[model samples]
Target: MGSLMHLIPVTDPADPRLAAYTSIREKDLTSGHGGRFIVEGKVTLETLLTRSRFAVESLFLAESRLAPLADLLAKVPADVPVYTAPQDIMDQVAGFPMHRGVLACGLKGDIPLPGEFISEDKPRSGPLLLLSDISNHDNTGACFRNAAAFGAGGLLLDERCCDPLYRKAIRVSSGASLFLPYAHGGTGLDMVNAVLNAGYTVWAMTPRAEAQPMQSLPVPDKLAILLGAEGPGLPDALIAAAEPVRIPMSAGFDSINVATAGAIALAHVFGEKQG
Candidate 1:
């Protein structure tokens, strides 16, 4: 927990102490200092501060919103400086309206590689969501939310997937992105092979007619549900390497959003297990 003494008030948007909060959009695209990422909204800030793996560098909050977070702030480490500014100053610093007025910057923990994440000793008895080329932040976050909701063991993301810690992603996920364990590494094919070697049945999600219906598919003791990018779906070669499955839809519709598909698949997989 943090004390009120840790709080520092800043009226100047350009103050060096507040640099971490400056031009957030541009910084998000270009900054790479110490694996740092932004946590937005009160829910996400709470989630960020609670996790041991993540270390807070600084917290920049709108002055008006500061008192509401006293309990949450008490949990923050004393060494982490907390900065408060008026709404106009925060808006000036972030170059945005700063509606939620809750922002914090923190460093990412040492993330495990895909192989390390799915070790040989760990038996896979539950479902894992495997993502490939899922570039959209919202979809990635939504998938994380769905995975957590359905009691997935973890997530395996291919190299092409966007960082789940992105501000929009975190906001969309409602902070589930921080709670779920995930590994990002290798090509989509590499992930498929690694999970297969780890005793997981990799089920590739596609909208093809030949694919097995998700509801009827047998639930393996260990399963990995593979989702592709937004429009193109999974690569054909990758799909060929695994058991292809699909969510049945109406006659004209070809498919649904990847995140929606993930939710449906996760529900079916977890539901069958509980049944």
Candidate 2:
């Protein structure tokens, strides 16, 4: 177990030391909180301390939460500070009710490049998930959860996608975004090409009539599944670049949620791998 001596009590909401947590909702609306992102709840905090590659700057906890999170708190590095406050003060500092009573600021360390992330030297046993223009945080989080649950090697997101580290995205992902290896930037084509050059077969998912049914093909040794935004879906050029595969659906319904589609496709490939 960890020592509680590092816990600092914060009675003032406007304390300069707690500045990183101020106006969280408003800050989340904008981008780039100086390479730092906030994570909420005990589960995510535990994931951050144990599984995530990111560094924890500090932890803010409500007084009532301290006893319940003792074991998890013990994992915090000695150098990091743990700030404790009453529920009211915590709510005031965060600009809303912090029902979870736990929050931590984490540093976004050096993110690997797409080429480096998918390098041939890196040994991986599962497929990769390539996302394009997925702006919804909930959808982005769901994708990460699906990727992690189904044993994806990693994920690659296009430039237009929302930050996986976003507060809501991290929560929605149930902290999968913290540990899952991912690189975000460049166009959808850039992501597809990177994996392809790394000697992986790319499966571009589409609902077009000409696309091959997913069940028709065998899972490759190295595969990358491509998913796009809800309404617009994958771009024509991107779909044309890889083996177009579709999940067989009803006559009128041509599509499903991107995250759901990703889960179904990943589950199919995962089951095949196990078999």
Candidate 3:
């Protein structure tokens, strides 16, 4: 059980509880833990707490790092433990500068399958973003933030994409990933098949000349923006299978960031903003 008073004080860096916390900048590139993701700082943690999908087991906060939050510590479930450490150790554990002064460890919960998220009644005709294989956390997170801000319905991620619940993605998402309805860790091919089968146009957002531009694209009433990675873009196999579509842009500029493209697409698709 967690107690603000009993918060275990760790003076040594060898503590096992702190091992999961990694630097935000380098973790996605080199963290050895397989199939594991991290969520750093306070806002991201708070967002995760609100969403019921993931189970947050513990939190590690630097005693000196008191600048990160409000007085909501007491509001967490009494059973969830909160640990405190020195600023230096917290910095080391985070693997980056610890401006926010708090870190948390959580297990990823089961997410909806591709088909389920598309028809997900939670958003009710909301714009959806489908990711092909965007490995970068920044893009994934940014895409989520835009989806939430613009009232997009939900988010769909294929197997190749980075975990949205991961610390880096969560932080970049400003915790929007949690607020947004997303079904993670599905296969691109399966997601494409399901979206197509469900009467969605599966507008593949790319710059291929033959692809229909966003201006002319028939983004359905219930839409899913098929986005790819930063440089690699969508795999040819996936694009070939999906309904070819693109977002219109200046001739020289091939595209915008996946997240930006998503926001633009959402505005166009849900232009009327019904209820």
Candidate 4:
């Protein structure tokens, strides 16, 4: 079904109505500074539309690209303005090539704390991803995608983690961040305590010798997989607090990219439960 939105034609790149779409990369959107964030590409936009919590403030698309998105556009509400501009004008407003030709500005809701994010009902069932100081947007986004792909219940982030709603991160996540339930709150240990209280078995990933190998680690009924920033891994104290586990590899190569490692861990935990 096609939506009956108000299709507003945009001729000038500097129009005031287009403020949210202007210089997206240079401005702050993730902190809810402007109460809005940019979402690009068809996949991300589609995901946002389906997820009810995220409200679409407006949409911008290259004139030539509108026809292809007719069905999806029809799903948008009539009150929302769908702005169409020439490909060149979009590039001017974005200050970069808008190759995908489709973009959207979505309003972000208030962020909940870690304790509020974890559900009390059936808390000891699915996997949960607990991220610590994962500063890089790409890695953070990738983890969200992984969490969604593997059916992890939700995500909890420490204070040092980057906003997953950042434009590049959302793009990298292919829109998974927009749909995945996540909250940023407290310190690393605080998040751990919240998950443990919610009935999850906390497992921290590390490359240390004392850590159990992934092959030997049992998949708990309700698991919280802890991951940290790439180079430093988890804090020594945090590792000691949780059951530390390592993905077995050749002796000379003990580490992997944090995103890759997260996917592997999620796969093991989920695969084991299913088996």
Q: Which number leads on lDDT?
A: 2
**1 or 2, greater by lDDT:** 2
- Give the Å error, residue 94, model 4: 0.4
Those runs of model 2 whose alpha carbons end farther than 4 Å from true positions after fitting are 29-34
Q: Give the top-scoring candidate (TM-score).
A: 2
Instruction: Show the colliding residue pairs in model 3.
Output: 22-94, 23-94, 23-95, 38-167, 39-167, 127-153, 214-246, 214-248
Model 4, TM vs. native: 0.95
**If scored against the real structure, what TM-score would every candidate get?**
0.94, 0.97, 0.84, 0.95
lDDT by residue for model 2 (160-207), tens? 999999999999999999999998888888888998888889999899
Whole-model lDDT, model 3: 0.73
Q: For residue 199, what is the lDDT in candidate 1? A: 76
Q: Which parts of model 4 are misplaced by more than 4 Å? A: 1-5, 119-125
lDDT tens readout by residue for model 4, 81-139 = 88999999999999899999999989887877788787535343468899999999899
Cα lDDT tens digits, model 1, 9-103, are 99888999877678887666213646777888889898887853567888899998878888888988889888998999999999989999989
Give the local distance difference test score of model 1: 0.86
| Model 2 residue-pair collision total | 0
What residue runs in model 1 are displaced by over 4 Å at the alpha carbon?
Answer: 29-31, 120-125
